[model samples]
Target: MKINGEVTTGLGKAAYFLSQEFYSLEFERNLGFVPFPGTLNVVVSDDYLDEINEIKNNCQNLIKPDEGFGAVKYIPAKLCDEINGAIVFPAKTTHEENYLEFIAENKLRDQMNLKDGDIVSLEF
Candidate 1:
């Protein structure tokens, strides 16, 4: 999915230079039916990396591997991270079956216009 987030850098070769390189990261697991990046989606702009980190934290806390079936599970996190975080857009709809289907078809992640450390609530 296209993450409308940041490219963390200052006006210099360090920032742009870094962008041209590759890196590896750890995935905590699925927070829900939504898929995490199999590979990095192009870093859009640090314009919103803060938001990405926020959602990542929230989603990581909420997700657990299902005991028998291995589906995603829900566990909530305390939301007082000090950094201002934005909730994902169409929050309520993410839980709806129809919306889930849409998410599956489109392949999605938190669409919240957030900063690094935001929360995206998925109602069960």
Candidate 2:
């Protein structure tokens, strides 16, 4: 499946969330890589809202957080057809439903040369 989106800025907490041992370890187990200590925030196309909801509906597992930590879910994804990653949804996230947070083994912003407003695509 494919979803179109535009890169966007986040609340600047991806590094903190990604660095937590609980999230890092769970991400490695689920996505096959310990993601770079950050995420690529994307504002998905409005047309893909249903698809995004479907993914959330089908999510059977949760990345349960340790005490005092927030929760998240992992959804497998491929970014720009090259980087392997997972879309993460934090339980305490401030983003809207159409906003997705992607975590990969590499620094996606640098690797893809992405900046705010850059269009991107994701495959699941």
Candidate 3:
């Protein structure tokens, strides 16, 4: 499956959470690379809302977090047909249905030269 969306800014909280040892260790073990301490926010186009919801509901590869944090489900994905990443669904996220969070080994914004409103494609 593939989806395209415009990049958006997030609340700037993921870095702190992602940097925690528990989560980073799990990500390294499961994803083969430790995620860059941040996420790339993509607001899915309205046309793909239903498909995004379907993936959210059906995703089973979960990363259980430590106490005080929430579990997250993730689907392995590729960004722009090049970067290896994952589409993450945090159980306690404040985001709406159209929002998709991506994590990769490198800081994607710099690596991809991304900014708000830039179009990015993810393939699962």
lDDT top scorer = 3
Q: Report the C-alpha displacement of residue 56, candidate 2, in angstroms.
A: 0.7
TM-score rank, highest first? 3, 2, 1
Q: Candidate 1 lDDT (Cα, whole model)?
A: 0.25
With candidate 3 superimposed using the best TM-score fit, by how many Å does residue 29's alpha carbon deviate from the native?
A: 0.8
lDDT at position 22, candidate 3: 88
Which residue segments of model 1 deviate by more than 4 Å? Answer: 1-40, 66-103, 106-124
Model 2 lDDT per residue over 1-124, tens place: 8877999988888898789998888888877899999889999877888878888878876898899888787788899898888888788877898899988999888888999999999888
Residues 1-124 of candidate 1 have per-residue lDDT tens digits of: 1233221212222222112212101112222223222211222335555654454446632222223222222232212222121222122222212111111111123333334333333221
Which residue window of length 10 is worst by lDDT in model 3? 51-60
Q: List pairs with backbone clashes in candidate 2.
A: none
What digit string (tens of lDDT, one per residue) describes model 3 on residues 1-124?
8888899999988999899998888888889889999999999878888887887788878999889999989889999999998988889889888888999999999998999999999998
- What order do candidates take by lDDT, descending? 3, 2, 1
- lDDT of each structure? 0.25, 0.86, 0.90
- lDDT for model 2, on a 0 to 1 scale? 0.86
lDDT assessment of candidate 3: 0.90
TM-score of 3: 0.95
**Which runs in model 2 stand beyond 4 Å of their true positions?**
none
